[model samples]
Target: MTEETGRTVKPGRSDSRPHEDLKLQLPSERRIHTQQPMSVTAMSRRLPQLVRRAFALAWRVDRTSTVLLLLLQALSGGLGAVALIATTATIGLVATGRIADHFGQALPSLTVLGLATGLRALAGVAITGLSERLAPRIGREGELTLLEAATSAELAAYDTPGYNDKWDAADRGADVSKELIGDAQNLISSAVSLLAAASVLTVLHPLLLPFLVAASVPSGLAAVRSARVHYLGMLATLEDRRLLGLLRWFLVDKTTADQVRSDTVADFLIGRYRQAGARIDRTTDEAAWRSARITLTGALAGGLASLTVWAVLVWLLTSGRMGIAAAGTAVIGLRAAATGLQGIVGFGARLYRLGLYLDDWAEFVELAGGHRIDRGTVRPEGPEQVEVRDVSYTYPGADRPALDGVSLRLARGEIVALIGENGSGKTTLMKCLAALNLPHGGEVLWDGVPTRALDARAAWRRTAVVPQEFARWPLTARDNIQLGQSLRGGDEAVLRAAALCGADEVIGGLRSGLDTLLAREWWGGVELSSGQWQRIAVARALHREAGLLVLDEPTSDLDARVEHRIFHSLRAPARDRAIILVTHNLINAAVADRIVVMREGRIVQTGSYTQLTAEPGLFRELWLLQRDRGRLPVQRTTTDG
Candidate 1:
């Protein structure tokens, strides 16, 4: 039994094509059948499950806020009913010339009305306060989840279009717990009023009750119509919302402002803002126009219902079947009931729309269940060769794989140097071995044990990577290095890491030394240069007890003299581990135990520097290019790599 439709449908490209509009698609299991008896038993069963989950999430923070918000929500509905009845009764008393009786019920009713208003207002305030408090905690949790997924998602998932959509659409449902609870309160308020009004109206005139419900049809439809329009409007221009968010950040952020003004980039920023604002304006304008049409439909429905109630009242009055005062009061009560019903519909629409966000949020949080990652407890028994299988990787939404059929192996305590041109997939390969990004098709084996079968994180613990960009935590220097070690009370380890990475003397010169806050955002704190920051990042990474070390352009930001000294100090210790160094500077290649030269995602040559320079290939070409540019003779160590 298919449901009746109010609008014509457009033809799609093909039935096999996945729908881009999320709302237009039906949940195959939850499709409605209008021809059947209107039984909501299925929907009702699902409602409690959703509510219970929402309540559980809300309860994670504290019990007080949740309980209080629900209480205020339910109480406010009862008060609205009392206020409506009292007003109608007041009209009746005044018509009958019983002025004193009007004040009795009316004054008490007004008091209830005021109380309800105050509570509702307080509830709004409380929700805002609670959400602000929860945002950071939930954000931290979400960040962790995101970091884990982005770093360790299945190799194939990263290469799929599905993951791409999920990655970009994340912000739409980011604030789930807070918004879900807040929306529940609104829905509860509407439901409570509908229950009260239905009870009161039934007792007044049972036959008229059906007519009241019938009159609600237009307004109820209009509410749902408005919500659909709002959702459509938001979806049509999501890039605009994202752009607006970014533009606002750039305009107001202290970090971006200096560059924004000095580099004449302000015009560019303003242009972006203008384009984003135009899109938002277009979307909102269409919604506002549609909203006007819905508002008119609702108004007509209410007016006709009011006319019906008055006509009924007049019939009773003129027939000498009821007093004028009682008749007037009944008419007022009937009209008030109609309005209350409409309010229920309006709020119900809000709840339905909020459900969209809620559903997306549930899916995002439970992405963990989707992963089902299997991890091993300890590293493949002992130090063995690091072997790369028939590896290939393709990034999400890309035309071709980044690497193809690549295989390599390195024994323990060997230094391997990788030299490649820009975008030759050197960084990507390094990230794979470090377990930051899983490969699209291939396996990495440690001591003959497949990494996929081992505890990925625990394995990662015994590895360190100096990635292209290092994260600068807004903390003191001491705390930054301390974060690397799992064990507490490792001041000696922190000091040793800092000393080994050429950061100890620089840190000691600060007023607070290692205790000094490294971020300028804090009071009395100072910022460091790029080279200084990189040194700190290296020290932090070195603080960990890792057997395999990957250094990706670690000295790129430093001066030539400093870099020369760093290599001299770092060589012996780095050689004791299975170290892989990635550099554009080929002068250091001579010192490595083996040099792997890559070009355009394929390993073109591999040998010692003395052997590779004689081969006519990429390594020689790049070396020649650098030499032509007068960037070389960079203090070559003359060690046989």
Candidate 2:
């Protein structure tokens, strides 16, 4: 049993909290194949692909920047090598004679050294500028690709196990895509420097280059291990971090702030936040300790190897196997090579970690996170009628179906009301009709063609929905109604729709009238009451000029007067379109030409309201219950009067 939700979580399923639970489980844990560190061979194979992917993205984003960055890195490395050789020549000139006598002879070497160093610095600056320019474009491209994949996927993808988790990982990958440019640049620079310096060392002596590589091996291993540890640890605790963020938002955001205080859940929520955070902290601390120990051991081994290399250099000089000038140059060459090796190891490790994330992004985009919409190419015109045929749907992680062999028919020029208790699949059936949820066992057809045969977006363009939780857009009152699309009649059409839903009265009172911003949080904005927002939501739906309209408890937040006005007016314009209304209010269902009563995912009753009231069934039972309750206020008022 957990202290947060007081629910008993099964063993081996520690992170299996329900989606509706305030305390979220780690979806990423279920998504990942393993938490183990990647093998060296695996990283070696993956790095080349990631590097190619990064450069490809950079080239596509800005070809000029990509070319300049490559040129600058190459130039910088070559200049550094030249500078080292020039320094050695100057040293030999000074060593072979008195400082005063060699001054004139050394001037040329000194000039070469100065010029090489100056040019390398300039190249470094140019590389930094180009990298900065390319990074943001790469990030933006990554984000656009992610959005395209996510938005194009089926709606059911969000309900599938590991799908949401994969999306979250991909989102993080997109955010860090900007770092790829820097990592790629560093890898290129390091490789060039290491190659150039090692060549110089080999010319000085055959044995010197091998010893330098030997010295760098241990540290390289350590850096890779540390990076792997950090990345795996982060992946393990991804959900806990998300949970903490959710709790903080609940505590601080204005929407939930009042509830948190009124319900006195601040202490409980804070406790959960701390507990989730502590879990992440423990994982992070363990990883840090392990990485530190590995790094320390590597450092000690590297130090010993470095000592051996220096001792060998000393012996070569003392025995006259190498000249003093060559030995001095060897020392500088070894240091430069070692620095390059260290940079290679460190940046390579970081790049490997980043590559893992980019892999997530790339994989998600390629496969559409396992939920790509693959419907047919048929483009739907305005649906004259929609029919459901033995449709059944079972949501992810559920045993029972939400809609079990449900069948219904809706035609133009009529209003169909779906009346049922909560969880009776009314909303599911409505979504099926809208082509939003493709059935698993049957089909929903528009104009006698299966919805799957119609292009999903084109089919949806003919739907106008005002759901129970309607959007309170933070835009001008006119835009709220128009929803970024202009009708043939333009402003006149918008006003007519608003007038139909009684929103014109609400708009008339705003400080800027139709131009007023609807969000109170912004400057020159005003907030509307719940009733007023419902009016706008209805108006927005009415303005769409769609053939099919679905209203799920549209009047739930409206006043009695507005609700009456909406219900009374629905049938007038519905003559030319099909309207589906889902409401618990029996009085509202009276306006529908047909009332479909659902129970336990099946249609139990179907008839006009007057016919259903005369028959004895769930509809009549609910009608009596509400009818008695409706008369109670009138009865009380009569007695009091």
Candidate 3:
């Protein structure tokens, strides 16, 4: 619950809230996780886990197309073998001085070559087109997976750095998976080439085939090792990489634009930018150098094996151990076999490398799957009774509980205000009430049912949280509200919510109103003042069909007059639903049915305005101070920001 939205709004106000005496309160409870970062060796240990995801992606795609594509590559490779035989036959005829007479056979062989080439081209085109189609589907699946993970994530996880790193890794893995079809196509081609070579070599000399196949082993192993090293390095660099994003935002973001230009912090950021860039450059250079070294060794080994075959042939020729024609075909088959093995090794290595990342993605996908909500019909129906009993929580890797032992109960349609100073657990407690967070201990009972047993997504369906830092969507004003509702863009419900928040007028004044995108990045888009954006955000939250509304400083950016007016206007709806506001404004505390003041994660006072104000404690002192401060000239007025 938020304190700001409980206040009324003045219908015609165009100024910012100017009450320095008024402030939003904190939550009475908090939950935090305390997990440590995974060691570099742990991430390294997970590389082998990626293979399953790669195979899964390939197998789950259109199977018929996969089979057809492989068939086409096989046809292409068979044509190559046929061309070789035709040329060799022609060579023998030419040596016998009879090639010119065999023009008819040559014409048929050329015709077969042309058809095979054309078919291969068609298969290549089909595979490319199919892959393009499959990419969007894969991307959609990835997004859905990510959304599920985010929705199911423990509330305290949002306050941690590990969550961000895991998210970045998962995002990269998804992107790579979308592009993996190209690698799959290459693998198919390589397999066909190897098969063709093997068939030809068997006829020439079965003994020579193993050496060609064995030559690719070193390159395959090197590629796998290189991929593992690269992934491990990437995992270790998450902190520095995250710092780079922050540095960019601090330097280049539009909201920060004014700050950097006026505060002379651009120079400071430039130094950080240089440091981050140099670090990334060093990593990149090392990886590239290592890859080059591996490639050289693998190539040298392959070349050495090739030279050995030539030496064996020369020895056999000198000793009269093999015929000239047999020797010639063997030479041709060995070269072809080596080429086929190269394709196999190349594809195998790439697939193996890709497997490492896909495994992480696979784990991410599994994580997302683990969080899938059943969307149960069980809901907090009539006369819901929410009780927070002996609840306590702490953040991950932190020692102190953000919220200590706290307990409270509320009936349906009750409007309560939580008042506290900064750092108190007011907001955190409210977030818990909204089911955004769970109690680290004890329970939050919904309609007398323990929240721990309730479906989290279902609880979310009946609740909406408009925090102090609300989201401003990079879309039209209409879309901002529509996003909150079951309906999408251009719906009448969207305009209605805008009207309720007094933002319809702002949209009407725009060049294209609801159609105009709000982001500068979009064509025909425009930016609004923060106050106006806040109003729109309010409307968006109001648009949601929620049974419980938790607004944390929802009107912090609003004018006092407007706040007063909105609270007055929304009173009817507020009385019909469970409304809890977290605010420190004594004026607002006066209107609430009851006020709960928190301090140091504990509820120090809870009562009606007169009850708490008359007591000689924290609430009494805070009220008197605000009451006296309202008279100061330096104090902000009701009109200006």
Candidate 4:
């Protein structure tokens, strides 16, 4: 889902017209477009920053390798210069017009030239070896860095406007981080070669240096302009590309595969994919046309400049301003300079564009995607009591608050059931209580200390949550229950938790029992029914020794017998932890020591199930409706706090 303009566009949902928002005119995109027809001055200003970032990233990944590769490139350039000088000496001796005498005189220069060329080739090989070794390590490091920053951000940041857009862009940058090393190396190599060639040309004839610069300037400008066009196009198509990815996921993901086939929506999804792709293609085509035009213009200008440089060389040689040997060497220097210039311009352009994407990555990392959780340092082992004092929270772009001035308390040895209709804030209140969502107004306190003063990670370790949509991790059955926290009893603890949630039966039937992988996509792995997965999720929470246990619609997928057994088993765990249960099913609420009936983000009534049922309020009203439908038996036992 893309969050923009203070709202989220749900996946697969778009404007009535398929192409309505395909071409984004975001501030970032607009800025890139406005900077179009990129000038030499602007490119020169930007190139150094990109180069520095590239080298910095490479150096961080493998310091010794990065230094070695850089030295090899510099040595290659120096060798090229030495070889050129040696060529000049040989040519000058051979130009004496005395064949046998000059041939003997040229042998030493020939030996020097051959030695430099061989050494340069060996250096190139070493450079390639170092780059190859560094690329994957660099790539992994880049991705790990991005993941660390993303994981540190607050959960609410995912809902903030433009956050997902920047995330997607940064993600793309991380995907190609290895290429940054190559681009940086090529830029350095080309730059060094350009300098070497220019130095030779200046030594041969002072005027030749000016002609070399003149010939290179146009193509360099064109390359920069082309890169800008490509970057701008990427910005324009960002949303469409994301949309296409969403469509592709829907088409291919196992979760949606059955629905697509059974509902015969494959064609519809394909059509959406086609439309999104077409939109991207249009932007890409426009960019290609613009780039082609710039390149053709540059080529034409460069061709004319090259002709002028060659004419000047011939004039110098004819006028005796340059000798036969010097002119011959000048020709070789001219070709070397031209090749070096092309490499510099071409690689520099690519490096600059990739840097734009990397800039997004760097910016996101620095800001922690704009909403990193910055809580206090005080760590709490567990909460004996959690108090909510008039806490209120409103989601971003929301018309109404999800929770408003709601006060409640949870303590150890108590099972407090929060009963509410959809959108009545039971889940939100639970999240606030767990410190997952800090309130905008008032505060939640754990053992007399405000949640804001608690170290977020440390506090979270003391809370176990089972939401309506629980994660189905692709791990071993035992690992799923243990969740990397092995208790003193090890397998015995896992088995006990599984037994409590009735997941032992599910595990027993698996091919590898506790060691069985949960994902069916892998060999020797298995998939579970929705009810079975719920059992495993419950087992996971039960296994964790947390202070607060928040279960939202935990029994939604369970059978009646399992649901009853699970709720009845809660009391044992509640003795050590504060339990907050949220469910629409009134029957399950009967298991709680205290029942809180919420309506429209406010607590309307609070009492024991029997006490609430005796009164004529929202709780009784809901009970009667369910009791009449035979969904709730009138003779269910109630717990006393």
Per-residue accuracy of model 2 over 220-286 as CA lDDT, tens digit each:
8888888888888888788888788788999998778889999999999999999988999999999
Question: Which portions of model 4 show Cα errors greater than 4 Å?
Answer: 1-37, 630-641
What clash count does candidate 1 reach?
4
Using lDDT as the measure, the top candidate is: 2
* Per-residue lDDT of candidate 4, residues 145-231 (tens digit): 999999888877876777787788778888778888888788888888888989999998999989888899889988989888988
Evaluate model 1: give its lDDT.
Answer: 0.67
What RMSD value applies to candidate 2? 3.9
Error of model 2, residue 256, in angstroms:
2.1
Question: Each prediction's Cα lDDT score?
Answer: 0.67, 0.89, 0.67, 0.87
Model 1: per-residue Cα lDDT over 1-641, one tens digit each: 11463343447554444455322222232223212221123333444555565566556656676676566556656665665565555555566556676666566655665665576567657756664554455444545555555555554555444454455444455544345555555456556666666665565556556776777777777776777677667666665776677778988787687888888888888887897789789889999899889878877976786577567657767887666545554565565566567655665566556555555545544673244354666554333567889888877656767787778787767888899988888887887776656666788777777776667777777787887788777888988777735455467768778887778876987789888998886666878888888888788777776767888988888878767766666665565567788988898677677899887777888998888888888888888887795655565576945
| Candidate scoring better on TM-score of 1 and 4 | 4
- Measured against the true structure, the TM-scores of the candidates, in listed sequence, are 0.77, 0.93, 0.83, 0.93
lDDT of 2: 0.89
Q: Kindly indicate the candidate among 2 and 3 with the higher lDDT.
A: 2
Model 3, 417-439: lDDT tens per residue?
88889988888898878877788
Q: Where in model 3 is the C-alpha error above 4 Å?
A: 1-67, 77-95, 104-144, 316-326, 369-377, 484-501, 504-508, 511-516, 630-641
What value of lDDT does candidate 3 attain over all alpha carbons? 0.67
